[model samples]
Target: MFHVLGALVFTLVGVRDATWTTDGMAAALLVAGSIGVAGNVAYGFDSVHVALGDTSLVDQAGAAVLIKPLGLFFPLTMLLCAVAVRHVAPRWAAVVIGLSALAFPVANIGNIPALGVAVGVATVVGFGALAMRPVRSPSPATPAASAAG
Candidate 1:
């Protein structure tokens, strides 16, 4: 249900952007939405395995590790946009990313709108701060350390 809605949102956004002059952001959104739809499809197919306890521990561990990062992708992408594109407004990018992050957890947990908005606002603020930070370069090691045997 939520997955379907997300897919629709992505598809619509992609279509909307196609008419504009924006480079690839809309395409990326469409792809992300498609991935979300696919993820939900895979999740649905796994129901039998989940019910029968037929899955492996390794698979479960890998899935658990993947989940957190999967959830973080939206926020991360917004941050990347802020850093990579000079024209994009960081605040708006952050808001969209935040909304996406908010939507997933809330939708997964069966809550909608409220949590979605909250997560969206919070994520935007957090990432916005991150966007403002200056890029730092790694320091060169001393010659003494470089010459060590």
Candidate 2:
């Protein structure tokens, strides 16, 4: 979830660096973030039951049919955002994202302590790096241009 937010920030920063305004990259990030957020929210409703291996929580009308697939969209969009911003983001940020993606399985699925630490570091550094980047505003027009106008 935080990873998805970090990706959004990275894209916004990249777009800002160019002109300090929204652009195509910003639009794409918004769309991706929307899909991811929606999926995550829907999945949250069934997460506890799913984690507990209790299928009874699901109603007979197949209300939970979209749970798994939607939940998967969160990570998929995060990855998509990472890839989309890689060329524009700092190299270190990109590297951190890559490490986090790789360590996700060991950290969350396998419950490996060592890999968990790696995932933690990658997440903290990646989000921190993106968050800490300074947004450079476009320079004001020169006096000559104003005078000419």
Candidate 3:
């Protein structure tokens, strides 16, 4: 559920940024973030029930050692970004919700597959949305004739 929610946030942010900003780079970031969300979801779908040390995709010799560390650092990064972008678009909502998703993964350090998915979705969605906002257009001026009359 958290993973799904994170993906939703990411998509919404991407769509918002693509629509509002002229910066191609921001749009690209959103795209990358979206991909991240998709990847996380796929990972969850493939292996959500395997118990630890029972042999699964991540059971490859050094894989667990390498990947588990990511869980530790990744959440910190996400939390930093969330804090750093509080003044930005999507603001606190994205930050808070995203942090919520990170709770499980950070706590379990990626040991819990389901938690990993949750954090992945939440981070992308929250960060992606925060980076983009709708552009506002100025109102047209009233006619001179109307004002003079």
Best candidate (score: TM-score): 2
| Worst 10-residue lDDT window, candidate 1 | 136-145
Q: lDDT of each model, Cα atoms only?
A: 0.44, 0.53, 0.47
Enumerate residue pairs that collide in model 1: 98-120, 99-120
Order by TM-score, highest first: 2, 3, 1
What TM-score do all the candidates reach, one by one?
0.33, 0.52, 0.39
Q: Of models 2 and 3, which has the larger lDDT?
A: 2
TM-score of 2: 0.52
Kindly state the number of residue pairs that clash in model 2: 0
Give one digit per residue, the lDDT tens place, for model 2 in 15-85: 43323223554556556556655555654444555568765323434656664455455454445555544
Q: Is candidate 1 or candidate 2 better by TM-score?
A: 2
Kindly report which residue stretches of model 1 are placed more than 4 angstroms away from their true locations once superposed: 1-21, 56-97, 100-149
The Cα error of candidate 2 at residue 48, in Å, is: 4.9
Error of 3 at 55 (Å): 4.4
Cα displacement (Å) at residue 13, model 1 = 6.6
